[model samples]
Target: MTMRRTDVVIVGGGLIGAWTAFFLARRGRKVVLVEKGVVGAQSSGTNFGNLRLQGRFPGQYPLSLRAQALWEDIEELIGDRCEFDPSGHLYIAFNDAEREKLEKYAAVSESHGLAIEHLGAADLARRYPWLSGKAVAATFSPRDATANPRLVTPAVARAAKALGVEVVEQCTVMQARREAAGFVLETADGRSFGCDHLVNAAGAWAGEIAQMFGEGAPLFPAGPPQFVTEPFPYFIRPSVQAVDGTVIFRQIPRGNVILAGYPRTAADPIRNRAPVPPAKTLAAMRHLTAVVPALRDCHVIRVWSGIEGYLPDMIPVIGPSMTTDGLFHAFGFCGHGFQIGPGVGLCLSEMICDGSTETPLDPFSIARFRGAVAEDEKFRREFDLPAAAR
Candidate 1:
């Protein structure tokens, strides 16, 4: 068995892991990233690419704001456009209750310096004629956008490799243990590596790594269904989501309409592959058409899903481990990690390099779940989308 040592070892090759490796390597730290599959071959690569910030968790807004800045300059950093589109994003309301929710969210989010414009029925109809009449009111955030999930992670990995970061693919971490000096990780292929610091950016599988250090995070693996329609003339520009969070759809410059919402996909987490059933696809399309009536004619050409770690509170766990030193975690993003992935990578990097970051990490710390079941339940109910209320 070959033995290796490095300054840091990252346990996943998704967006956060790859970006962390890139940043660390750029800082002259010897970094090694290992992945069971190809980089970005999971949720980080398969999501709807909705880089939105309209309705982020209150505590996540600061970090999300930093992420938006990185997305704006991502091409310069990664050497590729990654299909980032700044056309904007819209949240529509279909009823009075939905409108009230939109208003409340807008009011709170705007206070945090996020620019959100409210549009009533008449204004919405005049601005976005493609929307269905059921859209009684809407909110628009010009800064929220989209990116090509399939491109971002791989591009970042390549960039990291160019910076001398070792990326090992098709290597599964068989075992991990903390030593007096640092941590040692063994792979299924009989490769052993030691690092002074470890990052658990394992996406859906992150809870497994945290458990190795005695951290118990109640993270559930979920595969959200996503589908894309056959190419048509491009009409929709900005991405759109329902106020109740039941529907989300966006149009790419290529005219392919990508859609996703909250119904979990029937997935086998072990294989990391989830085939979207016909009924689920149809159900998602029905929700789409309710928002954009013209989409009723669009035929979906493909469907897929990716494994994502969802916490009970719908927030990610990002901070130092509670039980171990020299260990950091950035995982369980629930369903909205794609939009804030870059910022997350940067934040983890800062914590490692400078021991702190300008963005606050108190809310996302793993310690929050240490012994607070009642608080966790309350936050879960508060953050659960209406679609999941059932």
Candidate 2:
């Protein structure tokens, strides 16, 4: 088949790319959604599905709130159920230092218009007696929830196809450069595609593409390991996390739990090998037992992993490619983009289709890091985990 052209070509068909396709196609733009692997086969299909608003940075909370509302009605928008849960979040705190951080977070959260309640250890123990005695305090935000990432991702891709988006799978974009008319993209398969604009949503591998532009930034990639338990009676509601802050476990409707945390060896960025390790799995399981003893008896059924993009700042990069015209990037989600995918798609579509984005996209732009903004650098220090997570 002879290669064709389109108004836009999204170079990654994960939820961010797929949902962007959904919005653009709805606006009458011819869209080509290309993926290196199957659609949503990376971070979109893996990782913990915590659709949360709590713990977001001050400048980021409002956007997260907007995304949360969009997620509430995503089923109606996409004509497919996203399996969004609304059981809220509990930020566990183990000791004075961590508790102090949560206390500061709670204040910052309130100032930003989010409703989070501070709870002492006794209160936390009374509310959910299953929490291990190690948890000294907690901050509860009633708006967070967990969903099925594996299911929601493929569903979003199908929804985009239904909306007239041409999704191409297993098509690797070997090289991309600017053209006067648009962006010229040639695939590893010896096919060519032209687009009025380009969006780089290739999770983990986005840096590989960004480096092509000669851009330098602290873009770290990691294939974090995680696991899930065999279905059992549902003893947990919402997500149960430890105050010790080592583990995060969320249960699905099927009564199975998802796990992610510090590892014996954090996967290197360049190599970026992805597969849940048994050591990380066991660590998460042990941490889960310490947080909620009830989970100790549940047998784990599967362990898996995916490489996620991160900037030292911990916020996503959502704006246009500064040096390249007809190019935009939407990687480096830092593991939080899934909950905000709908809003991100809408934001990117507005920018790509209309040439201007509505939200406060300035906060996530790559240009900020290069200049004196340095917010990303500060965030990296504040949210630093131990070597296990690094």
Candidate 3:
């Protein structure tokens, strides 16, 4: 076997992995990134690119705030093109319950430094006359934005390459182990690499890698169904989501409306493909059409799904592995990893290179789930463990 050596080895090529590699390489670290397939080929590449702080979990607000700043300066810092649009975000409330929920969330979000403008039915109508009459109230975040997922991972990888980061694509790590020198990994194609630090950013397959080191996290694979309509007149300006979260849709500059809302379908990590059911697609269209009546007459162009890692608590497992020194993990973003990908990467790089990040990551530690086997067993009674691959 051919042996190679590096200062750091990243075991995933998603946005977090790619951004981590870019940050490390820019800091003059010798980094090697390994991907089973193309970078961003999975969830990172296939997600709805809405970057909003409106509906984030409270624990994530701090990082989300910092991430929003990073997104504003991404192109200048990374030297890669991200088709980012600062089109803001509009969250609609169709009824009294949803209106109350939106109002409450907006108040709490304001405390976190994210100012959300509460919009009444008249205000919503005055601002967005094209919206369907179902909107009773809304919240607007002017700092919220969108980006092209198809452009992020590859761009980050390219920028890292410019800084001399080694990218090994189409290589599957068959075996990995800790050694005195650090971590050693062997791929299926007779290749070997060793590094002093190992970062497990493997997305949906991250649980298996964590288990390789005796760290058990109940990470599950979720494949959300998404579809886009054929080109039409662009009317929707901001990426919109219902307060109930039953639907989310955004109109791109090219006039295609990308949308998703159905339940997450299960996907096999090895194959990395999940079939989108026709029935679910139809249901999603119906839900979207109800909000934007113009979509009722639009032609469906394409439908698809991608695998994402979801933890039981819906928070990410990011920070040092409990059982291993010099090993870190940054995966399991549930279904909302894209918006925080850059923040997670920056924090991980800081923790590794600078011993800590200014942003708080203590809440995302792996220790929270450590020695929780009994909890897992109990939780399994409600939701099967086979579905929770961790």
The Cα local distance difference test for each model comes to 0.86, 0.78, 0.85
TM-score leader: 1
- Candidate 3 residue pairs in backbone clash: none
Q: Judging by TM-score, tell me the better candidate of 1 and 2.
A: 1
Put down candidate 1 lDDT per residue, 100-159, tens digits, no spaces. 988888887898888999899999888899887888898999998899899999999999
**Who is ahead in lDDT, 1 or 2?**
1
N/CA/C clash count, model 1: 0
Please give the RMSD of candidate 1 to the true structure. 2.7
lDDT of 3 at 248: 90
Q: Which ten residues in a row have the lowest lDDT in candidate 2?
A: 375-384
* Model 2: lDDT of residue 261: 64
For model 3, residues 298-364, the per-residue Cα lDDT tens digits are 9888988888887777778889988999999999887778999888888888888998888888878
| Candidate 2 local Cα displacement, residue 98, angstroms | 1.3
C-alpha RMSD of candidate 3: 3.0
